[model samples]
Target: MNFAYELPWYRKFINESDLVFCDGFGVLWGAKLCGYCIKSDNRMTCPDYIENLALACEQENISLFLLAGKPGTVDKAIAKLKAIAPNLKVKGHHGYFEKIGDENEAIINEINKFRPDILYVGFGMPLQERWILDNLTRINAKVFLPLGACLDYYTDAVYRGPRWMTDRGFEWLTRLVIEPQRLWQRYLIGNPLFFYRVFRALIASSWKNYSKMSKFWRT
Candidate 1:
């Protein structure tokens, strides 16, 4: 939401996505407030479904390429994933390289060489989205998935709180507690701002409807 609010291009990117799924409770609540019938079951966090996805990919013989996390995080995640789906064909690269010039070109060439069926890029929000938008034509992957900090959570590099809290939509609170210094602004200011925007939009929509009904009654 913060990304959408701050970056017009990011919002456009999401609006134009082939498919978008709710990853958190905030989005579900916002959609509900907007009169959309999104439910808790619609929320699909990566940590919760990654193993299942990996197993399915293995069974379907789909290859995956992970491009995110710190130097060792991707490898750790791949190891854990392979344990669950031993036959899963997957490769990974850390997300520390430059996204331009020869380095970026080389990275693109590497990915093209692999020609993975699915590419998971997780350098966090707008960065991942922007990278994909800029390189969509150059990349050969069939599916491009942007997952923020997913590798960190998958490899236990970052604690994802307890299942009870995460499942119930209090994961943001847990994250705020864990990385208060780094994430204070994101949850503190961003959460309220998101809901405020939703409510404002809802009110505007209601007013528009009310005006239309008033004219219909007068006629």
Candidate 2:
């Protein structure tokens, strides 16, 4: 929601996406306030569902290429994934390379050579989304999945907090506590700001509807 609120282009990208799921409670609640029937069960965070995704891909004989995380982080995540699904075919590259010119071309060539069924890019929100928009036509992968910081959690490079907190939509609180220096603004200010925007939009929508009803009654 913050991404959409901050970057108008981001909303267009999401709307153009073939599939979009609720990855956080903010989006779920926002949808509810907008009169959508989204529920907690509909939320699927990558850290929570990644193992299952690997297992399912293994069973379905789908190949995965992970392009995210710092140096060595993606390799560690692939190692953990292989442990969970021994037969899973997966490869990975760190997201530290340049996104344009020679370096970007090389990475694209590498991915095309691998010909993965799914490509996971986790350079973070707007950047990852922009990369996909720019290179989707040239990429050989069948699916483009943007996962922010998921590999860090998979490799334990970043702590994801207890299951209790994460399961109950308090993962933001946990993250705020864990990386206060890095993420203070995102969770501290961004969360409340997101909700405020949601409510504002909801109220505006309600008033519009009420005005329409009033006109109908007068007619």
Residue pairs with backbone overlap in model 2: none
Kindly list the per-residue Cα lDDT of model 2 for residues 64-100, writing each as its tens digit: 9999999999889998999999999999899999999
Q: How do the predictions measure up, each by TM-score?
A: 0.96, 0.94
Q: Assess candidate 1 and give its TM-score to the true structure.
A: 0.96
After superposition, the stretches of candidate 1 with alpha carbons farther than 4 Å from their true spots are none
lDDT of each: 0.93, 0.91
Each candidate's root-mean-square deviation in Å? 1.2, 1.4
User: Distance (Å) between predicted and true CA of 129, model 2?
Assistant: 0.7
- Those runs of model 2 whose alpha carbons end farther than 4 Å from true positions after fitting are none
- What digit string (tens of lDDT, one per residue) describes model 1 on residues 108-168? 9999999999999999888999999999999999999998998899888999999899988
Best by lDDT: 1
Hey, what RMSD does candidate 1 come out at? 1.2
